[model samples]
Target: MDFDEAGKSLSLEKDEYIELVEFFFPAAEIDINKLMTANEKGDTELASDAAHSLKGAAGNLGFMELSDLARSIEERARNAQVTGLSLKIKELKDKIAIIEEAFEKHKNS
Candidate 1:
């Protein structure tokens, strides 16, 4: 994700960007956790719904990699392709960690 482009396009000042990201972080985390839980329980519909929501939210916040991974997870879950969902969920979690680290760095900067 090119946050520079997103920042400029959104006219996001340092504080404003931080605030926006912070606002979404909790919900994103919760949705991801819920999605994982749903997947574990074999609730494909709920898992897909959560993943889809997370994808849109992450995309809106410029977490492009995370968004893409979430979208893939959602699609695969919707199609009942459970074989790779765990791997994809792990990837999504890793991306989320990256986003969190980036946000912390930006906050300190």
Candidate 2:
């Protein structure tokens, strides 16, 4: 939740970085849903696509934790390995929720 560091990496003001982060949340949630659905359907290729998209987006925004999680999922999917993906997806969701909560606290402060 180092917004200052993230803003520096992106060359954005704090408020601008926050704006992008706010925009990313819902879109990321959609991607997560797509990943979950794809996983349940055993669509590894589709899941990989979703995970790759999320990794790229998160990495670009300096959210490395999210990017790394997504990358792991992507790699597993690319290998056609669907084992324990539900647990990984849940972990990703938990991280996202924690980040969102921190962001809300930042807003209030």
Candidate 3:
């Protein structure tokens, strides 16, 4: 959640990075919901797709923690391994919440 580092790594100014993150937050929430639904339905394909999308977006924004978590889910889903996905999805949501809190702090500053 190092905003300065993320902005530097992405070659974005602080304001630009903020704008990108503002967009990312809501989209990430949607993806998380999709992941939860996919897990509940045991739809490996849909889960994999959702995780992959979230992974890529997070990585692009230098949210490596989130990206890594999503990558695990994507890899598992790709192998049709649905076991414990609910827990993993919860972990993902937790990471997202942490990131959101950091973003809020940055905005308030």
Stronger candidate by lDDT (1 vs 3): 3
Question: lDDT of each prediction vs. the true structure?
Answer: 0.84, 0.92, 0.93
> What residue runs in model 2 are displaced by over 4 Å at the alpha carbon?
none
TM per candidate comes to 0.90, 0.96, 0.96
lDDT by residue for model 1 (1-109), tens:
4555676677888567668888888998898898889889999999999999999998887777778889999999999999979888888888888878877886666
Q: What stretches of model 3 exceed 4 Å from their correct place?
A: none
Candidates ranked by TM-score, best first? 3, 2, 1
**Residue pairs in steric clash, candidate 1?**
none
Q: Which model, 2 or 3, shows the larger TM-score? A: 3
Please list all clashing residue pairs in model 2, or write none if there are none.
Answer: none
Supply candidate 1's per-residue lDDT for 70.
90
Encode model 2's per-residue lDDT on 1-109: one tens digit a residue.
Answer: 8777888889999889989999989989999999999999999999999999999988989989999999999999999988999899899889889988988998888
| lDDT for 67 (candidate 1) | 84
Which is better, 1 or 3, measured by TM-score? Answer: 3
